[model samples]
Target: MSTLYTETHIGSMQLKNRFIRSATWENMATEDGHMTEKLYAIYKELAQGEVGLIITGYANIVAEEKPNAGMMGMYDDSFIEEYKQLTELVHRNGAQIAMQLAYGGTKTTYNVGERVIFAPSEVCERGTKTLGKAMTIAEIDYIVQAFAKASLRAKQSGFDGVEIHGAHSYLINQFLSPYYNQRDDQYGGSLENRLRFLVEIYTETRKLVGDDYPILVKLTACDFFEGGLTFAETRVICKKLAAIGVDAIIISGNIHGKANDMIGESFEGHTIQPQGYFHQYGDVISREVNIPVITVGGLTDIDAIETIAANTNIQYFALSRPLLSEPDLVKRWQNGDRAQALCETCSKCRTKRGNFCIVNKQRKATIAGF
Candidate 1:
């Protein structure tokens, strides 16, 4: 009934309002994968601009399993103090922040010094041309510990919350969808069995962060591939998630190549090739689930943004391009001074891997033209 800007609660975390700077893979970090000055400044602006909560770009929990060399990682505690500075900046700007803990399932292109890629049950991520090693039960246990350990480190780093990157057909996504995973073990087979990895991640993560700290996940509204995690199934999954003690869920989807490949982009087909296009799926999940939800996919229109809020039934409005376009957007909007501009949809924002926004500058554009 109320608009998105109305303040809301996501688990124990109190948002100043309901506008979320969605977790985008801002390639703005060190090659070794750490947030640098530009990364800090870009987010700091959003914080000052009055964004409700910020779910930062994916930060890998381990190194060799990195899908790409550009992914930021929290692989070691040595980096925690460094991350502390970034979180402190966000807090000073008046926003709470959550670090997206990630691990590339079979999509990892970073082979620098490793040769093994493990999935809950290796069917090799749908349409991919290559194959990764199947995760042995013992290996699966280690991976779960990696997530839990990373979450504990996140808490120690002073982040407000930890969000498991289960959407986009990543590690957890593959296991959730029957299309990618093919095993007869307890970790596979039925829907309940398929979701074991996520349940494990959530259960252990809860132990790591405690009841006071918020824990969330970004899961697909649908895989958009045959027999993947469809909206219908997502509804069922959400119920199970509630029992597992998940705090919030970010509604997201994956773009597959011509077939349902989890990692690589298809030359042509419905894989989110076009930009700013993923709210319908989010709404589907929001309607079926009772917990707070955040949705994103090429979102960058005031009317479109308002439509997502006005007629929709979700708790938050999320954006990757818009924030990359202008960090101060919410601040300007709140002061009755925001404008509309196409995100260029260049997607150069996600392409550069570890460079600052090459497409848009911050605070320079007057929020007066939309």
Candidate 2:
């Protein structure tokens, strides 16, 4: 068996393999953020496919602050019973699952102008062009408590871990981004101040979930924008997070005004970047931190994955679009069919009903024509 198939630990959570299904919005939840059968099937497929760890689509920690429609909610206890079923289902399939908690800041148009969108500073988001209200001290405390409560709910509902969504210019990431966070308060200004929000969230959540439970962070290694969070500063942040007892860090980056790092153009209206586009960022952070480091973004090739794993300190690899196109990709590779994933990075996965791979649909249609 390849090393990628071997067991490993992220904190106390044991993963069956090195491949993690990075959180991708399935957009299948009910309007009120309840789990639906469609959402259950999505997890069932991924867990049954033999991935090591599955990080769910980011769940809304604030009930009225869902920036995306059909998002899973953890704002209250109403989610506990249904999520228990979700966690149990994944466990039965021999996989561990983590629930990613997020509060979308200005990266939204979901309910723009209808409600307040909080941020570290009142800035116009480059990506969404939505202006966010500067979060008050009271509001900041409220969100910290919300994350803590949601993490407890995750533990009670049987999640193996909880990942703080601190990437993609979301609420937490906004606080980390210098371009977005222009406040002079204790929660903003210097890098240390900018980091206070996440630290508090982790501290509060740790108190509730205890020191033994895994608390992972999906961190923006760099903002990839002018006057934004830099990789040099991010290294410092990673070291601090490791020092603070975060079980693992998943390295990702955000490009202001852009959604992803895909380059070139494809016939399907989206292009794929070179495999492991974020590996450079993760490689450095892995060396900087003692805990496990996972890299997510444009990773699809098995040989490349193996080479990177062998050469770098990055402990894990995560995939999103590739798995959307081939849920059984990990199993396929392990079964000796190591062909790279078929996902073209078409960017057509999002739909009104849910996220479905357009390539898969076309392939099925072609087969039906025969």
* Maximum-TM-score candidate: 2
Pairs with backbone N, CA or C atoms under 3 Å apart (clashes), candidate 2: none
Candidate 2 has its poorest 10 consecutive residues by lDDT at 361-370
Per residue, candidate 2 scores C-alpha lDDT tens digits across 219-327 of 8867765798887788888899999999999987674323344444221222323777667778878988899999888777999999889988989999998988888
Q: What does candidate 1 score in Cα RMSD to the true structure?
A: 5.0
Count of clashing residue pairs in every prediction:
6, 0
Q: For each candidate, what is the lDDT?
A: 0.73, 0.86
Tens-place lDDT per residue, model 1, 150-243, is: 9999999989999998887678888888888887999888888988888988888888789888998888767876666666777789878866
Superposing all C-alpha atoms, what RMSD in Å does each candidate have to the true structure? 5.0, 4.3
Top-lDDT candidate index: 2
* Residue ranges of candidate 1 with Cα displaced over 4 Å: 112-114, 126-128, 256-276, 353-370
Task: Tell me each candidate's TM-score.
Answer: 0.87, 0.94
**lDDT, candidate 1, residue 155?**
92
Residue 174, model 1: lDDT of 84
- Runs of candidate 2 with Cα error greater than 4 angstroms are 256-273, 362-370
Question: How many pairs of residues collide in model 2?
Answer: 0
At residue 356, candidate 2 shows an lDDT of 71
